[model samples]
Target: MFSTGSDDVGVRKAFFGSLVFETVEKTNGATSITTGIDNPVPIVILFVVLTIVFTMMQIIYRGLKQRRDELLKMSGS
Candidate 1:
Protein backbone atom coordinates (compact mmCIF):
# COMPACT_ATOMS: atom_id res chain seq x y z
CA MET A 1 0.00 0.00 0.00
CA PHE A 2 1.21 3.50 -0.88
CA SER A 3 -0.06 6.53 0.93
CA THR A 4 0.00 9.97 -0.65
CA GLY A 5 1.34 11.51 2.60
CA SER A 6 -2.21 12.31 3.61
CA ASP A 7 -4.71 9.96 5.25
CA ASP A 8 -7.16 10.75 2.47
CA VAL A 9 -5.62 8.78 -0.41
CA GLY A 10 -3.96 5.44 -0.93
CA VAL A 11 -2.98 2.96 -3.62
CA ARG A 12 -2.23 -0.71 -3.33
CA LYS A 13 -1.22 -3.52 -5.60
CA ALA A 14 -1.62 -7.25 -5.03
CA PHE A 15 -0.74 -9.97 -7.47
CA PHE A 16 -2.14 -8.68 -10.79
CA GLY A 17 -4.65 -6.30 -9.32
CA SER A 18 -4.45 -2.70 -8.18
CA LEU A 19 -6.68 -0.62 -5.94
CA VAL A 20 -7.03 3.10 -5.46
CA PHE A 21 -8.87 5.01 -2.76
CA GLU A 22 -9.44 8.73 -2.39
CA THR A 23 -11.28 11.08 -0.08
CA VAL A 24 -12.89 14.31 -1.14
CA GLU A 25 -14.25 17.15 0.94
CA LYS A 26 -17.38 19.03 -0.03
CA THR A 27 -18.11 22.71 0.54
CA ASN A 28 -20.83 21.80 3.03
CA GLY A 29 -18.17 20.32 5.34
CA ALA A 30 -19.15 16.85 4.28
CA THR A 31 -16.69 14.28 3.00
CA SER A 32 -16.96 11.67 0.27
CA ILE A 33 -14.89 8.57 -0.24
CA THR A 34 -14.16 7.07 -3.59
CA THR A 35 -12.58 3.73 -4.44
CA GLY A 36 -11.76 2.00 -7.70
CA ILE A 37 -9.64 -0.63 -9.33
CA ASP A 38 -6.90 0.76 -11.50
CA ASN A 39 -7.10 0.05 -15.21
CA PRO A 40 -4.14 -0.69 -17.55
CA VAL A 41 -5.98 0.54 -20.63
CA PRO A 42 -4.53 4.04 -20.39
CA ILE A 43 -1.02 2.70 -19.99
CA VAL A 44 -1.43 0.49 -23.02
CA ILE A 45 -2.74 3.40 -25.07
CA LEU A 46 0.15 5.64 -24.02
CA PHE A 47 2.71 2.97 -24.90
CA VAL A 48 1.17 2.44 -28.32
CA VAL A 49 1.11 6.17 -29.01
CA LEU A 50 4.74 6.62 -27.96
CA THR A 51 5.84 3.66 -30.08
CA ILE A 52 4.11 5.07 -33.17
CA VAL A 53 5.64 8.51 -32.57
CA PHE A 54 9.17 7.13 -32.21
CA THR A 55 8.77 4.90 -35.26
CA MET A 56 7.64 7.87 -37.36
CA MET A 57 10.55 9.96 -36.06
CA GLN A 58 13.04 7.23 -36.96
CA ILE A 59 11.62 6.80 -40.44
CA ILE A 60 11.72 10.53 -41.07
CA TYR A 61 15.28 10.83 -39.83
CA ARG A 62 16.46 7.94 -42.04
CA GLY A 63 14.70 9.38 -45.08
CA LEU A 64 16.25 12.79 -44.51
CA LYS A 65 19.71 11.27 -44.09
CA GLN A 66 19.29 9.28 -47.32
CA ARG A 67 18.17 12.37 -49.19
CA ARG A 68 21.15 14.32 -47.86
CA ASP A 69 23.53 11.57 -48.97
CA GLU A 70 22.01 11.56 -52.44
CA LEU A 71 22.38 15.32 -52.69
CA LEU A 72 26.03 15.11 -51.58
CA LYS A 73 26.73 12.42 -54.19
CA MET A 74 25.16 14.52 -56.96
CA SER A 75 27.20 17.57 -55.96
CA GLY A 76 30.42 15.52 -55.94
CA SER A 77 29.93 14.34 -59.56
Candidate 2:
Protein backbone atom coordinates (compact mmCIF):
# COMPACT_ATOMS: atom_id res chain seq x y z
CA MET A 1 0.00 0.00 0.00
CA PHE A 2 2.99 2.30 0.28
CA SER A 3 3.70 2.36 -3.42
CA THR A 4 1.65 5.08 -5.15
CA GLY A 5 2.84 4.08 -8.64
CA SER A 6 5.29 1.80 -10.43
CA ASP A 7 8.07 4.24 -9.52
CA ASP A 8 9.29 5.27 -5.97
CA VAL A 9 6.24 7.47 -5.20
CA GLY A 10 6.35 6.61 -1.48
CA VAL A 11 9.85 8.07 -1.09
CA ARG A 12 8.85 11.23 -2.97
CA LYS A 13 5.68 11.65 -0.85
CA ALA A 14 7.56 11.26 2.45
CA PHE A 15 10.25 13.76 1.41
CA PHE A 16 7.77 16.43 0.26
CA GLY A 17 5.57 15.90 3.32
CA SER A 18 8.51 16.45 5.68
CA LEU A 19 9.49 19.65 3.90
CA VAL A 20 5.92 20.96 4.02
CA PHE A 21 5.61 20.19 7.73
CA GLU A 22 8.80 22.06 8.53
CA THR A 23 7.66 25.11 6.60
CA VAL A 24 4.22 25.10 8.27
CA GLU A 25 5.48 24.75 11.86
CA LYS A 26 4.97 27.93 13.92
CA THR A 27 7.74 27.59 16.56
CA ASN A 28 10.44 27.30 13.82
CA GLY A 29 12.68 25.50 16.34
CA ALA A 30 13.10 28.61 18.53
CA THR A 31 13.95 27.41 22.09
CA SER A 32 15.50 30.41 23.84
CA ILE A 33 13.84 33.01 26.09
CA THR A 34 14.38 36.75 26.01
CA THR A 35 14.14 39.55 28.64
CA GLY A 36 13.49 43.29 28.89
CA ILE A 37 10.24 43.71 26.96
CA ASP A 38 10.21 41.69 23.77
CA ASN A 39 7.05 43.50 22.61
CA PRO A 40 6.20 47.23 22.69
CA VAL A 41 2.75 46.85 24.27
CA PRO A 42 3.79 46.57 27.94
CA ILE A 43 6.34 49.37 27.77
CA VAL A 44 3.98 51.58 25.81
CA ILE A 45 1.10 50.94 28.24
CA LEU A 46 3.28 51.68 31.26
CA PHE A 47 4.57 54.90 29.74
CA VAL A 48 1.05 56.05 28.91
CA VAL A 49 -0.26 55.22 32.39
CA LEU A 50 2.64 56.94 34.14
CA THR A 51 2.31 59.98 31.92
CA ILE A 52 -1.39 60.31 32.76
CA VAL A 53 -0.76 59.86 36.48
CA PHE A 54 2.02 62.45 36.55
CA THR A 55 -0.10 64.94 34.61
CA MET A 56 -2.95 64.57 37.07
CA MET A 57 -0.61 64.92 40.01
CA GLN A 58 0.87 68.10 38.59
CA ILE A 59 -2.60 69.55 38.06
CA ILE A 60 -3.56 68.81 41.66
CA TYR A 61 -0.31 70.26 43.00
CA ARG A 62 -0.79 73.47 41.05
CA GLY A 63 -4.34 73.82 42.31
CA LEU A 64 -3.29 73.35 45.92
CA LYS A 65 -0.40 75.80 45.54
CA GLN A 66 -2.73 78.44 44.15
CA ARG A 67 -5.19 77.91 46.99
CA ARG A 68 -2.41 78.23 49.57
CA ASP A 69 -1.18 81.47 47.98
CA GLU A 70 -4.71 82.88 48.03
CA LEU A 71 -5.08 82.04 51.72
CA LEU A 72 -1.75 83.71 52.54
CA LYS A 73 -2.78 86.90 50.71
CA MET A 74 -6.17 86.98 52.52
CA SER A 75 -4.39 86.76 55.89
CA GLY A 76 -2.34 89.91 55.02
CA SER A 77 0.79 90.94 56.95
Candidate 3:
Protein backbone atom coordinates (compact mmCIF):
# COMPACT_ATOMS: atom_id res chain seq x y z
CA MET A 1 0.00 0.00 0.00
CA PHE A 2 1.29 3.44 -0.94
CA SER A 3 0.12 6.55 0.79
CA THR A 4 1.25 10.14 0.15
CA GLY A 5 -0.05 11.09 3.62
CA SER A 6 -1.02 14.48 2.21
CA ASP A 7 -3.07 15.63 -0.75
CA ASP A 8 -1.09 18.84 -1.35
CA VAL A 9 1.96 17.19 -2.86
CA GLY A 10 3.15 17.99 -6.39
CA VAL A 11 4.36 14.59 -7.56
CA ARG A 12 3.38 11.03 -6.68
CA LYS A 13 5.13 7.87 -7.77
CA ALA A 14 3.51 4.46 -7.95
CA PHE A 15 4.99 1.07 -8.77
CA PHE A 16 3.04 -1.84 -10.13
CA GLY A 17 4.46 -5.07 -11.60
CA SER A 18 7.87 -3.72 -12.75
CA LEU A 19 6.31 -0.49 -14.09
CA VAL A 20 6.67 2.84 -12.38
CA PHE A 21 4.24 5.64 -13.09
CA GLU A 22 4.56 9.27 -12.10
CA THR A 23 1.55 11.42 -11.54
CA VAL A 24 1.55 15.20 -11.15
CA GLU A 25 -0.94 17.12 -9.12
CA LYS A 26 -1.35 20.84 -8.91
CA THR A 27 -1.85 22.20 -5.47
CA ASN A 28 -1.95 25.66 -4.00
CA GLY A 29 1.35 27.47 -4.55
CA ALA A 30 2.55 24.54 -6.68
CA THR A 31 3.79 24.63 -10.28
CA SER A 32 0.99 23.94 -12.73
CA ILE A 33 1.19 22.33 -16.16
CA THR A 34 1.55 24.50 -19.23
CA THR A 35 -1.25 23.94 -21.71
CA GLY A 36 -0.38 26.72 -24.11
CA ILE A 37 1.60 26.89 -27.35
CA ASP A 38 5.29 26.19 -26.90
CA ASN A 39 6.55 28.02 -30.00
CA PRO A 40 5.38 31.46 -31.18
CA VAL A 41 7.31 31.55 -34.43
CA PRO A 42 5.01 29.18 -36.26
CA ILE A 43 1.92 31.00 -35.02
CA VAL A 44 3.35 34.34 -36.10
CA ILE A 45 4.19 32.99 -39.53
CA LEU A 46 0.72 31.55 -39.97
CA PHE A 47 -0.86 34.86 -38.93
CA VAL A 48 1.26 36.79 -41.42
CA VAL A 49 0.40 34.38 -44.21
CA LEU A 50 -3.30 34.60 -43.46
CA THR A 51 -3.15 38.39 -43.36
CA ILE A 52 -1.46 38.56 -46.74
CA VAL A 53 -3.93 36.13 -48.25
CA PHE A 54 -6.92 38.13 -46.97
CA THR A 55 -5.39 41.36 -48.21
CA MET A 56 -4.91 39.93 -51.68
CA MET A 57 -8.48 38.69 -51.69
CA GLN A 58 -9.76 42.16 -50.78
CA ILE A 59 -7.73 43.77 -53.54
CA ILE A 60 -9.05 41.31 -56.13
CA TYR A 61 -12.62 41.84 -54.98
CA ARG A 62 -12.30 45.62 -55.29
CA GLY A 63 -10.82 45.37 -58.77
CA LEU A 64 -13.63 43.10 -59.93
CA LYS A 65 -16.27 45.45 -58.46
CA GLN A 66 -14.70 48.42 -60.26
CA ARG A 67 -14.67 46.58 -63.56
CA ARG A 68 -18.30 45.57 -63.17
CA ASP A 69 -19.28 49.18 -62.42
CA GLU A 70 -17.44 50.47 -65.48
CA LEU A 71 -19.15 47.94 -67.73
CA LEU A 72 -22.55 48.89 -66.33
CA LYS A 73 -21.87 52.59 -66.93
CA MET A 74 -20.76 51.93 -70.51
CA SER A 75 -23.88 49.89 -71.26
CA GLY A 76 -26.16 52.51 -69.73
CA SER A 77 -24.55 55.45 -71.60
Which candidate ranks first by lDDT, i.e. highest?
Answer: 1
TM-score of each: 0.58, 0.51, 0.57
Give lDDT per model, in order. 0.70, 0.52, 0.59
**In model 1, which runs have C-alpha deviations exceeding 4 angstroms?**
1-6, 9-37
Write one digit per residue (lDDT tens) for candidate 1, span 1-77: 44445555344443345445566667898766666768766667778999999999999999999999999999999
TM-score result, candidate 3: 0.57
Clash total of candidate 3? 0
Q: What digit string (tens of lDDT, one per residue) describes model 3 on residues 1-77?
A: 23345654333432322222233565665544323334466667778999999999999999999999999999999
lDDT of 2 by residue, 1-77 (tens): 23334432222223323321111212765333222323465556778999999999999999999999999999996
